[model samples]
Target: MPDETTDTTAVAEQRIAALAAAHPWVSEARLTPDGVLLVTPHPRATAALPTPGPLVGEHLAHWEEVYEWTYETAEGRHAGDLDLSGWRASDTGEPLPTAHMRDWVDRTVGLVLAQGPNRLLELGCGTGLLAHRLAPRLEGYVGTDVAAVAVDRLSGAGLPRAAFVRAAAHETETPPVRQAMEQVFGAGVRPDCVLLNSVTQCFPDLAYLSAFLHSALTVVEDGGTVIVGDIRHAGLLEDHFGRVERARDPEAADADIAARVASAVAEDRELSFAPAAVQRILAAHSRTVRMSVHARTMAYDSELTRYRYDLVLHVGPAPGTAAVSETRQLPWPGRGSEPLAVLLRKALSAGPVVLHGIPNALLTDAPDAVTPHDLRQALTGTDAAVLLDAGDPRMLAVAAPADRATAATARSLRAPVGRLAHEPLPAFVQRRLPEVLRDHLRRTQPGTVLPRIVVDDAPKGAVR
Candidate 1:
């Protein structure tokens, strides 16, 4: 293989060409003078979903490509002052406000500092976003990533009490990482806090996350905290897609929007988890650790504030570190129930309120769910219909009856939309609307910040 470190124009074009081939949606790919490979997708590719959104595989091969490309772009564009945070605005594909990104960094720094850790370990450090901010404050810091570029760059940065390693998340206990950690902290010592921030979404699945956590908890100090930050919320998966679809085309018909949303959700390669899912996974280690969920406090109404959250795993049973308890419970509004605005106002006055099953507002007005009959009607003149009759495996699973499915089939039948061939549609009304509504409430109700924080004790019984 050619040297991965240096990329000539031809090499860059070849790499992008291969990536584009894997992604049929890509219409144009070009390398900028600065070495960033910019890809432009076909206009209708999202609705069409000709192929999966991005490449995903073991050890986050896809993310490695992305970060390598991103690092080059940031290095060229920003030069001496590099913002390695990777927080970008979607509309323009530029980095979001620096202050907003720093707000999150500051908050995370405070959380890790509050633990008073002598040593800190960050998995998927991604060019030292947190390492640069935290390395000076701690006695020892070890940052790891799959990207050699990041590790090599950070290694030369000469940050005090910091070591950079090229390792995957699950490789925490491996020889390379262990040697690096030993050099920083000392022999036989573990980090007081292990952080994986804005990185879990790149994880392949829940199994990968679980495996990483198992390794993380084992390597951290007994009373240390494992902070997992900027997690994409699984419960808001649909809402996230819906927002994207609407933003892509504000005037798109509901049917078109619905179709594209389904396609985007299906093709999404990033891993997301409901707070409950993460909590359940943490349960296995509950006997020793307490789990707490926190919402991003970023002032902007972007993806981070809208769909992402944070988790802090307090390792070992410390005397005063009990789980957060909900002080009140409130039912969300229905057709006949009190207005959502009013209910939220009431809930705000009540401290630490737990809102139950809030319906997703975006889907509230979405097209009806797809039934077999609806599918048969919608697919009447389409190629998908012929495939369905021929029992194409992709067409077999029609959306509608399944709670998670929507009119994915119907949407595809009408347009170039390709999302319906696999997954089915759920009820138009669903409990997936909390995060968006939270944003709405924030805008409509001044001084009303609903805490999306989730606090729960570890499962009833779990081993380390």
Candidate 2:
């Protein structure tokens, strides 16, 4: 038998060909867009991504042990196993019920809304910590995890508004999740918000996040929000090392920082992130999103200042508008403000705006039109749409409903565009309108600086 891991590229390809031949429906077997077969620049970074446990079995004996690890019903207390926090603070110190943990949970709940979203589904529902807390907020809430022990415990406690289920990672066992979701809500029910709070850290790689995100897109209803909550940036991990050293050695608060981090590298749980990684992935789908930065809060009696800053993201627009981007990773092309762009921003502030009848060529390009890749990149996060007319002049209009208002907002951007605007916006925008036309709209307009972000207004939505 051929060893699967040791197979050469030619051998792997030949096997794929044979497998395709045996399957009649196999149109073609292919690699991913990023060429998974071609390169893995940082394999070790995502190697230990979490999987199902508590454990994966059909027998009763395993569950009995799962129960033993977590609960001492005799003592009426929670314990080891199935709880994410079990190993997290094991070496830190005894629990004094820190305020930081509570703050984290409360801040997380705030994202679903202060007063809306009738239904919510949370993936990787670790111990239902957030689930139990959120029961009173929404009409229906579903929390799912692979650990049957945790599910069994939460289900037994019986929160009225929430239900817990045993389900594997969304990638490996998507059907089970869909089924469990149906069982909890009903056959045709869909959640308004899908939460992955502090969860993606466990995944094997960005590839897993990508697969699960696509799965989420299929499962979530249109205009429904997908909250990819509490993810790390490359900088967060660096900040953490300093905090860890401080915690471990109070006297050496000013110790050689680099050396301390090097010594603790293998002994500690290191974080991993790819720069602007999640944004790049979401860009491909064109889903509107708002990202905010979250830092860890501390309890009164806590002995540590842990390194953590949760990035909260809100995906899917209120009704219209989808977020786009300049590059796979960058949100904006850094083309600063243009006349029309500024005018549109003001119009949006007061209410929705519609451009007067203009040439359709500006959109679909009749002849000298707007189709360049760089041109498209400049228009990344606008909330406007193109009007399709059979023969009449085409127009561009904001996509929000008739009564649109500038509600709460979240925005993120790296570069300042005020200086860049001097370069001038492409002639396509100017072509849509005559140069002498701006005096009328500028009367009521207040200058507002728009940042280039996928979307805005959430926990981390205002991130720079």
Candidate 3:
């Protein structure tokens, strides 16, 4: 049998090494007096590491190498049992290394503080960097990851306010992780915000990635927000920075490397969005979509990169309600009075007024452009109105030789008017205009001519 004391020491060292590998910033991790491991000398000691290549197809083989050793090593396997919560202080005796990690924790903390303390669930809460940072500002915080070792470490760290769940990526069936998530968040709890920071790109493919995204949405409450940040295909350093190689012909080698790197980035990597694919998927499930890109330096890379994030705000309508109308129009400028207003008033006074307008360019632009206030003022006294919406042909057909008086009377209204061309009017209005006017005149006993005068006292039978 293996020597127990020696094996234990070896196991401890191996576990520490695995953690350091998985978490780049972790320099040294030792078991504390309380069984918690203290990580010392943060990863920032060295200049930023080169960005990794894309995780796609053949490139995935290279990418796997970066994580497998750290994840599968002997120490890494047993790290699940080591707890860090009981440790009073880190071996480094320094504050958490914020510089090397993404600033999302700070941003999230600020958002929670401003919006009132909210329950937060951070998926892929690596090393609990963001969880620890946001715990104080949240009513409850739960973090879930596939790494059992990380869960054990978090438990030992004494973060009573935050709970950890060991769930593998794309493995929702994992019982330990699922149960832990439900216990802290509560069966009824739906996240107000679901944060996916530099996490989505790690998936094996877009199909897997989208499935997780949908799951995240399902867990978020209606009217909640999903914040996703980080640039896809951002790990390609050779493409980002030109390489200088010494060769028989230095210039030629440099050119060749540049060409190769460019080709590699172009062929092996691309953003996760597939044309209008994301929009199409979100439309069916989400109510509103807001997206923006901010240029920032990566905490680990220190190189300038564009951070693209999309916030899908849920806004489903009330049950049984029809879809809201979506009509937007800017008020017309330079039109002072509105004909609709005057027509409404006239209709209210005399039972209903017929509004006439020519379809000429001037008229087309006039009434429709009038301000709402002006239109309201014009219609203030009217009870009901009908728009003549007449083109030039319709206007000409209605304004007959005998109807000149009526046309002149309509022209005198303070509303904007358009000149009509000489043409026969549309049959519908031509047939209805006379009947409308006749009824109005008979009811109000105004003058009988087309432009009937609004006479206070007129013989009722004069026009008849």
Best by TM-score: 1
lDDT of all predictions, in order shown?
A: 0.56, 0.42, 0.38
Greater-lDDT candidate between 1 and 3: 1
Q: Write the per-residue lDDT of candidate 3 for residues 1-464, one digit (tens) a residue.
A: 88998787667545543543344333444444444333332323211112211212223343344433444343322133221221111123333233333353443344334333376667766556566667666667777765555566666776656687765344433466456656776775766766655555444334434555566666666656555544342322342333212222346666676776666443333233311233334555544432212122223222212212222223233223211221111112222354554433433332122233322121124433332223324544333111122111112111111112122222322232332111111121223333433454345443422222121211111000
Worst ten in a row by lDDT for model 3:
455-464
Candidate 2 residue-wise lDDT, 1-464, digit = tens: 98666566445444433433233212233333332211111222122224321111111223335444644332323432123343234336454353455555665676456325677788777666677777667778888776666777788876776777676446423666667667666888887777777655444334446556656655665656666655543333434556557767777745586677655542332223432454455566656654433322223212222322334344456444422221111112222355445544444443343322222222234432321222223333754332211111121122222212111111123321111101011121122121111221233223421111111111111101
Cand. 1 TM to true fold? 0.59
RMSD of each: 21.4, 22.3, 34.3
Best by lDDT: 1
| Model 1, position 103: C-alpha lDDT score | 70
What would you estimate as the lDDT of candidate 2?
Answer: 0.42
Query: Of models 2 and 3, which has the larger TM-score?
Result: 2
What lDDT does candidate 1 reach at residue 380?
35
Q: What value does the lDDT take at residue 412 in candidate 1?
A: 23
lDDT of 3 at 463: 6
